[model samples]
Target: MAEVLGAVSSIVTLLDLAGKVIEYLKSASHADDDRSRLRDEISSSVAVLMMLKARLSPTSPHVTSLQTTKTLAAPGGPLEQYKSDLQTVASKIVPSVGTGRLKVTVDKLAWPFKTTEIKALIASLNRQKTLFNLALQDDHLSISLALQGSTDALGAKIDNVTNDLDNVKQGQKGMVHIANSTDWPELTVPVQTEAQALEEKRRIEEWLSPLNFWITQDDTLRRRHKDTGGWVFDALEFRTWIDSPGNMLWCPGVAGAGKTVIA
Candidate 1:
């Protein structure tokens, strides 16, 4: 519970920093395309943090969750680092209160960050967002493991989450953005002959897998007991991962955890 409280405090501070960034972006009259994009990206990142805050609220379901929160709130950890970076950005972009009127006016009309800098900030935000998403998934898995009463299984899930966190801390892929349908008209695909299409299909099949995954999926579904793993479908992390394009739900459990059935 102490760890959870610490994690929530970090999240609240981050939210406050993020709000500053958004506010300054909105107020910048001379903001260009990059700044606008940065604003949108920051907003999306904030949503991930909001979800994380909700997960840490009240009592988390299991020990793994407490472990995760502890790690996140540790000194020099991901959440602290994220907060530091965001504060730096906010300091650069946000206008100072004690500035002269003319200086404030000039600041409001000028964009503070370079294009390269904006891109780097966006990338950092995306990385941290991915890390938080993984944390939320860890919390969900912890709940399931607690219900099953498998201590070994819970430890294994904790290990998996820790590995994932390390990778994310080293900088990994972030939220997958799905382009709107309106962007379809901008795409230019080449025309393919019947032979070419067949060749392409063959390549896709080979790339997907050497064996038929559909058959394996069918078998797993057949083995699934009715109402089993239904909680997974209803979990916040699961629904968020589904509704948000390119987001992944990392469900790690020992064998017989019904992973395939949940899928």
Candidate 2:
């Protein structure tokens, strides 16, 4: 039992470190004019997180009941049942949690909640972009679909956005230069954008710059916390908190009850 408690303590320590890494990764690119810098920073963090995930993977089992019920399985939860199930899960992982699944899951996510939803969305978008690039070389993938998957108006708009990526592939075939110039604005036409705005925005948003999305979301989390009675932030309730600007330092999915979000 002593050994078990010790391991749990170690797991908690690693989680605290990982949380700091995420917070640092998210804030590393503190810039307004470029997004690629943010993406690059995030990518670095993601790499570290992946390594940590491999090192601290947790055990997550898929539990099923009433063999026939498998046909009706869906995500919109059976709330009370989910709460009860996770309570059981919490008990099972307390002392003997593995480094692969339980540890990763506990540290990286909020069970029964959409905590990592934004990260998942970003990852999915990146994967789709990669797959699209790969399809460029395939003979089977039709040009139209490969270039732009057919769908609705929003789909068409997204397809238009993909064109910039195609332009990048073409432009890369030429020469590269590390351009450095402060984005200046005239009091007259400020916010009207200029020659390098598109490229700058791309750099800041995609890979090597501080990202707008990350900053906005971090700020949002902060505002949400302030709105709640500072009680939402009692350190005693949390096992740990990273240096991040949000309430992310705690054991998220492990919380015993819902902390209401009231204005």
RMSD of each: 19.4, 23.4
RMSD in Å for candidate 1, one decimal?
Answer: 19.4
Candidate 1 lDDT tens digits, 164-208: 555543332221122233456554434344575456556644543
lDDT of 2 by residue, 1-263 (tens): 33323333433443454344344334332232222332453344334323322322234121111211211122321112222322332333233347655443333332222325434534543443333222222111221232233325434554566576557544543322211122433222223234454665465435322224454334334434343555545655442454444665432331112221221
* Candidate 2, residue 109: lDDT: 35
The ten-residue window of minimal lDDT in model 1 covers 172-181
